[model samples]
Target: MTKVQKGKLISGLSVGKKLTVMVLVMLIPFSLITVFLLYTLNRFGNSYNLVVSNVAIANQYNLEFREEYDSVLYQMVARSITKDMINEELGLTNPDDMTENVRQSFDKLVTSSTSQNARKSAESVLKLLTTLDNRCNDINNNIIKGGAYDVNMSALDNDIRVITELIQERISEYIYYEAGSMELIRSAMEAERIKLIRAIGMFFIFFFIFVLFLVIYLSSAITHEVDILVGEVKSEQINSRNLELKLLQSQINPHFLYNTLDNIVWLSEGGRKDDVTGIVTSLSRFFRTTLSGGLDYITIKQEISHIESYLQIQRFRYRDILNYEIDIPEEFLGYRIIKMTLQPVVENALYHGIKNKRGGGTIKISMHHQGGDLEIDVEDNGIGMNSEDTANLQRLADGLEKAREDNAGFGMANVGERMRLNYGPEYGLKIESEYGKGTIVKILFPKENSN
Candidate 1:
């Protein structure tokens, strides 16, 4: 739907793009944190309920175990008493041995039952078992030896009952302690869940506020720059046509014109009227085309003719030092270009590249229509430039701030600026050069924008 959704806004987009990126970055972490917090809160709430339920279950189980242990202890005591009666009736000689066996069996049962509960419960059970064992030993000794006939059986029964009560009390105490601790844990978890929810809410609010501030600041900055650029473009459109006219008029060198006129006058006085007439006719045609600023746009054929006239005048000046040629498709003759645009690039190749060579060089100009663009190239096999000279030429295309003392030139800057004004920034001069080889100047314009 949008460039950001397609991932194309990451690098190439403007300030608005940055806002989208920031929002995305903040939202991912925010969503993750929100999900984690909700999960934790839900888990904690469930765990607290589970712990409460388990505490209740443990209490019920402990009560049942305590009741069962009490019944088993009572039965063990009854069995011990019955064994003493048998020993007395049989006149057993080793009653102590039988008593010890019974004590051992009772201890093992008590230990196994108490292992399920806490420390207090186990200690209480052990104490109860030890007391019962002592009572059994006393019964065996008294009945077998027929001594202590006045012993109280009620005291022994009361002692066993008291031990059973103590064991139950210990179990109750443990259940109470565990339940209290679980309640405390549930309270703490509830408080922590509340705090986390608040923190997440505050984080979202802060994130939204920061995004709002950033978007406002970026919008203002981008709008200001765009407005300034629009104004500059409007100003250029208003002034460019007049500037092109002035440049065309200034193309002719006044001193050269005067000298040529003098030569024609001298030739007329010497009876070489035919040669004088030919020079006059060429000069007249050249000035007429150069000064005609009525039409701001003209066909490629017309611009090429204008350049031919300019080159002929230069050829008269540097007769053998410069050679020129042009090749254009017949179909492209009707295609239009800004007036006087192509000629200046060729002039730059002559003055900057070939004029300084000793043996002179050939200048070849060619043009053709590509798919959606026009390609024009001016190449010369003259004294080519070094890397630094090429860089300097590039700077001149933007308008020379400071003239180079070594290689002073003018046509490159004027031609480049005119091209930019006429056909946007894309259409301009591109220079390629290599030292001791040659130089090529290329001009590109849109085919759709032609006449």
Candidate 2:
């Protein structure tokens, strides 16, 4: 029972054990009552049958006594000397036969009778029958010796009548006692039936109420816990997204800066002072705007400035091989965008597109408004991708591809996921590429002013 309490004890039990306890709690009482009730009913049936049989036996004993007594009285009054009468009395001449008859009758009485008093009274009646039978034999012998008239059978007749009345009284008492005992047993059976019904009914009512509360308690507890878990998961996801965004914003592209510094060193060795100054200044401005005071979102104007610095450095390094253009309307420059959104696309064009082409190519950055949505496209006329490579790039940008040590795919995927998380799924990166011709990447988001 202690295991059923809502605590560590109940949690320790398995599902099967809990169900077993519940079944036993209700079933054991019912089983006990059923067994006891059946036993009582069986006892009542046996008693009822015994009483009926004993009553029938008593009636038959009375009838047999009356027939034998009347026959002897008629014979003695008429002075008859019938052979059948002499033979009937001669049968009682053997004391063993008389004793055997009494024994058999008493045995039947003992076997069938339920009450001790009833058995004792039946025993007395059997003894009286035996005595009366013996007396008749004496009267029969006297008649046989001196004839029925000289026998003086009045004494025998009176004796037989008195004994018959006594036997009748005893049988009546035995039957009355048996009837009373049967009535008492029946009353007890009725009481037990009522008690069983009440006990079982009360147990079931309490069990039902307990089960109702258990269901309600368990349901409420589980539902409340599940709701709390979901809330925590959502909160964690938002925090993780913000942390990742900050980490990405603080990251400076070491490879690009390293190559630019190497180019600056080469130019310094060649005595190109003005070119070194221009590259160093652009690199400074690029890193400054990329950090953006550690904020996740920045104005459209700042977004353009960072990408312009990046393009300038690249153009200085490539000289006559690489060219680029930016055509964002002034009216849209005050609007907001996620920081570092365009720079990664511009980087992808430089490394994967324009860098791969033999003659290099032009990279174009443009912006337009369609309905309430703002769209920015980065198009490159360089060595673009085939269908498979385009699909692979899309997978990387969507974060379906796992990151490896040397992979540069995280930048595009991070920017796409950030926009989606901030605004919704409707705003993210979309890619269109044609094999060996060009590639265009479009970024879409709702038009909102900088705050």
Candidate 3:
């Protein structure tokens, strides 16, 4: 593949890899949350099912116990009747004695039962049997021995009915209590099931939203940075082209240099030492500054001094027609700026704005602080540009050709390229002008102290 195509492919691959890694990072927590939610939901479902089954089993046990209790009551009544018949056959007459005898016999019957529940049932039966036995004995004794009906057998019958009714009522109460307990358990289980469902739904909704947001954020952040990198690469390619042009331009025209130096030498030989000395000194200084390459950054103070030196040479060449002023804040002298940044803009002001005028105009340079940025303005009250010229200026500022055949100034394009290379596109030169009025070129930079 061609080198350009290879560069594009590599850039795409790198960005894709970063996106994949970021997606994985975002998904990890979401995956864990999903697993935890599912596990918790499974546990809750199992617990709900278990509780429901337990309640059903408890209900069945309650029914069985109620039936058993009723059977025990029936057996108790039957045993009481049998005991009364036996006591009557034996002719037991005294109430106290008969009671004692029946109580002892009933205790024995209770002991004979096979199960503990049966034995407990027998105790209640025995109490009833003893009452009936005593009543029968009293009736027999009253009839045979000619005493009044002393024991009140009807009252004993009523007492037996009351006891039976009490047992039935107790059974009914137990049934009611058991039914209420089952209902409570069912209600609790239903509430818990609803709560668990709601909790699981909310967890899924929130987790989904969080994961979605994270994915979007990661995608946006990675894509924006990649775009910036791509732009920087494109800018670097353009700068490479410009560097090639500059290198080619550095080669000297020997004939022109020889002629200029010969004139200065002849003037010195003719006893014009002061003029020759000044010209030679300016030439030396200019050549020295131009050849001092490989340095990219310098203080604003140094840049201003370099501009002043260049302006001094220009003034000697053009006489007093050109006047310039540089107004900079004292505190900003220490701030670092790109080398040759201001020199190019200043050159543009002098060449395009004041060079062709009948009488040259003033060039004003001012620097100040505004909020978190430094503002530098190069204003020239010379032959200003019209609307079309302003449009061309804007195109040139964006590193595009506008009226390139005219070759308005070399420095405008150079300064714009340097600004974009150093601080990105947001900060650069902004030019404002009106026909025959004036031109103002502003350079915006981030405040060094703020940085």
* Highest lDDT against the true fold, candidate: 2
In candidate 1, stretches whose alpha carbon ends up further than 4 angstroms from where it belongs are: 1-251, 266-271, 399-407
Rank the candidate models, highest lDDT first. 2, 1, 3
| TM-score for each model | 0.42, 0.44, 0.40
Among all windows of ten consecutive residues in candidate 2, which has the lowest summed lDDT? Answer: 239-248
- Give the worst 10-residue stretch by lDDT in candidate 3: 242-251
**Every candidate's lDDT:** 0.59, 0.67, 0.54
For 1-451, candidate 1 gives per-residue lDDT tens digits of 7967767646666878777788888767666765765576466545445434434443443455335434433333444443434445444323335324434533543343322333344344455456555655555555456544334233233333333444444444434433444434545554764575465556656677775465445435634553453344334323322222122412444765796778777778889877677777777766666666544467888878877876776676677899988888888899888777766677667777788788889889899765689988889998889999898887776533322323344556656655664467777778889987789888888888795
lDDT of 3 by residue, 99-122 (tens): 454356446534443234334434
| Model 3 local distance difference test score | 0.54
Question: Which tens-of-lDDT digit does each residue in 59-119 have in candidate 2?
Answer: 5554454446555554553554433453475432233343355457666986678788878
Candidate 2, lDDT over the whole model:
0.67
Candidate 2 wrong stretches, greater than 4 Å: 1-250, 449-451
Considering lDDT, which of the candidate structures 1 and 2 is the better prediction for this target?
Answer: 2
